[model samples]
Target: MEILDLGLDILTWAAILIGCFFVIITGYGLLRFPDLYSRIHAGGMADTLASFLILGGLALQSGLTLVTVKLIFIIAFLFITSPTATYALAQATFVAGLKPRVDEGQLDDTPPTDKVEGGKD
Candidate 1:
């Protein structure tokens, strides 16, 4: 076996480090944020981004044809599914009428009128 190519090894390590950093930041966001809805945003966004980064790093490190193909599938799945899931969760929050933290009141606890003009028909 030849000495590990320094450049390739460095690249591999960098990718892995970046992926791990995304996960760490996600965890930190989840811990530091206030409110359940806000925390959900943090978690949803973090998991999506971290999943992409990790799949990408793993793809980079995969050195074989079949492994590369499988890695590509993983990347594809993550790209397609993660954001969709996040969007669904956010939509659920909206449909459930959870007031945004900035609103500073539980306004949504009362149903919003569907009227378009100053809540008038």
Candidate 2:
């Protein structure tokens, strides 16, 4: 029983750590990415994954409890809503004539260059 509990604790901590790492990366991406579309993509995807991982870790640590149930419900809600929200935002922006910046000249066989349009090299 003790060994089982120890394993569970380790798993819980690992999940939480990974989740936190994703959150950091998301923040960096939100800052580093150019254009609203890119920022939205990074924030939407990474935020959802991080929330799931963190909440799942908490649910595992809590075991069969009300907290776990609540966390599960929250995760479910996020799973349904995050992508939908992202799509809606993108659609609205597109309808409002906010086009994503695409370098059409670079669409061919040439490799990407180190020079970013609005970022440091």
Candidate 3:
């Protein structure tokens, strides 16, 4: 039982440390990314991953308990909503005429066939 406790502690801490590292990287990307799209991508992906890691770590520490169950629910909610929210935000920005920054060879020169006009489909 003592060994098992120690092992759980180590695993929990490892997950927490990794999650913290991702959170730091996300902050850096949000600050330094060249474009809104890149920033959004970093923020969304990192936020979801970090939340999962951190909450999973906490769940592990809590063992089989109500707190762990609640954390799992929160993780699931974030997993579902983060990407959807990011897509919605990006879509809204595009519809509002905020064009993404394009780089050379990133896309073809051809214009989009379905153009959004006045935020309409």
Rank candidates, TM-score, best first: 3, 2, 1
Task: Return the TM-score for each candidate structure.
Answer: 0.69, 0.81, 0.83
Best by TM-score: 3
Off by more than 4 A, model 1: 1-4, 103-121
What is the lDDT, from 0 to 100, of the residue 33 in candidate 1? 65
Can you give the lDDT of residue 111 in candidate 1? 36
lDDT score, candidate 1, position 21: 88
Q: Which prediction has more favorable lDDT, 1 or 2?
A: 2
Candidate 3 matches the true fold with a TM-score of 0.83
Give candidate 3 regions above 4 Å deviation: 104-121
Question: What TM-score, to 2 decimals, does candidate 2 have?
Answer: 0.81
- lDDT ranking, high to low: 3, 2, 1
lDDT of 2 by residue, 1-121 (tens): 9999999999999999999999999998877776777789789856588999999999998889899999999999989988888888888777666567685543343332333343222
Clash pairs, model 2 backbone: none
The local distance difference test score of model 1 is: 0.67
Residue 71 of model 3 has an lDDT of: 93
